[model samples]
Target: MLAKSFALAALASAAFASPLVVPVSGGDTPPADQVTISGITTSGTGCPQGSVGQFLSADRETFTLIFDSYQAQIGPGTVPTDARKFCQINLNLHYPQGFQYSIMKTIFRGYASLQKGVSGTQQATYYFSGESAQCSTKSTFTGPVTKDYTVEDDLTVASTVWSPCGADLPHQYQVPDHA
Candidate 1:
């Protein structure tokens, strides 16, 4: 009898411990209506000249960014073993109006594609959970609750020998402009 009682208590605790999961529309590539492109900035050696694109959901609930393509180096020396091409991406959530909340945790769902010395692709899906924080007196409430994350795994063309190279052959994130 005692064992059965303990089992019931454990089950109750487990149920309460589970967090509430919020459902979002965009899985990886957010639908057109669910995103807005604010601005994009690109800087790097691999693809120094690049562009930025963004998507903000119509309701302002979700935000996503794509940092085109940037040039990067994968190996050593001016003539690296591989000249990697990559890009950066970000997907996050925004607080709904009149609602107060704090993010307790964030989950990233996606895949990474690495092409030996060339271009690659990266996909990201973000899930967030938090406690409610009443938004009453606050005059201004803006921006995402979490950090602006980046994923640079895409490479364009691979080179067995680094023919065209530069001093800055590393990966770096550019500050995106707001739309």
Candidate 2:
């Protein structure tokens, strides 16, 4: 019995040592309708609505980190016709690091997609439960990085104006990139 217990412990330790690699792509990018903004202010289109760039391991090699929030925009003006019966998506990520937490809030806005027109701003909300850090430094990557993630939103479609005069997504709209 003691030997069996020891074996289980060893297996658990080995499993814990492994970092969770989320294979990302398709799902990370939010649909045209949903909006992705920041926490404090409704600034740029915060992170790729659903783009998972890398693993949020329990061990992070660096202090600062980057994360992407997922979202979707829909309707004739971008505002969900009905808030109560609108959309809801829950995003959860697991880093190899253990117990670190990040928060994501949705910034709903109205705009025209070259395809449709809608204009308004609303705040969508959700809660995510993800694992903590495991590495200290940021993982290095070449070319466009990709990873997989999950999202939950009310699966309802809203009508939108076929033509928008001036439609645009939320962008940092900053002046210039510092060298």
Q: Residue 153 error for model 1, in Å? A: 16
lDDT, model 2, position 87: 23
Please write out the lDDT profile of model 2 over residues 85-122, one tens digit for every residue: 12222322223211122221111112112111222122
For each candidate in turn, the TM-score is 0.24, 0.20
lDDT of 1 at 94: 27
Candidate 1: regions farther than 4 A off: 1-50, 75-179
Candidate 1 residue-wise lDDT at 105: 22
lDDT of each: 0.24, 0.21
The top-ranked prediction according to lDDT is: 1
Index of the highest-TM-score prediction: 1
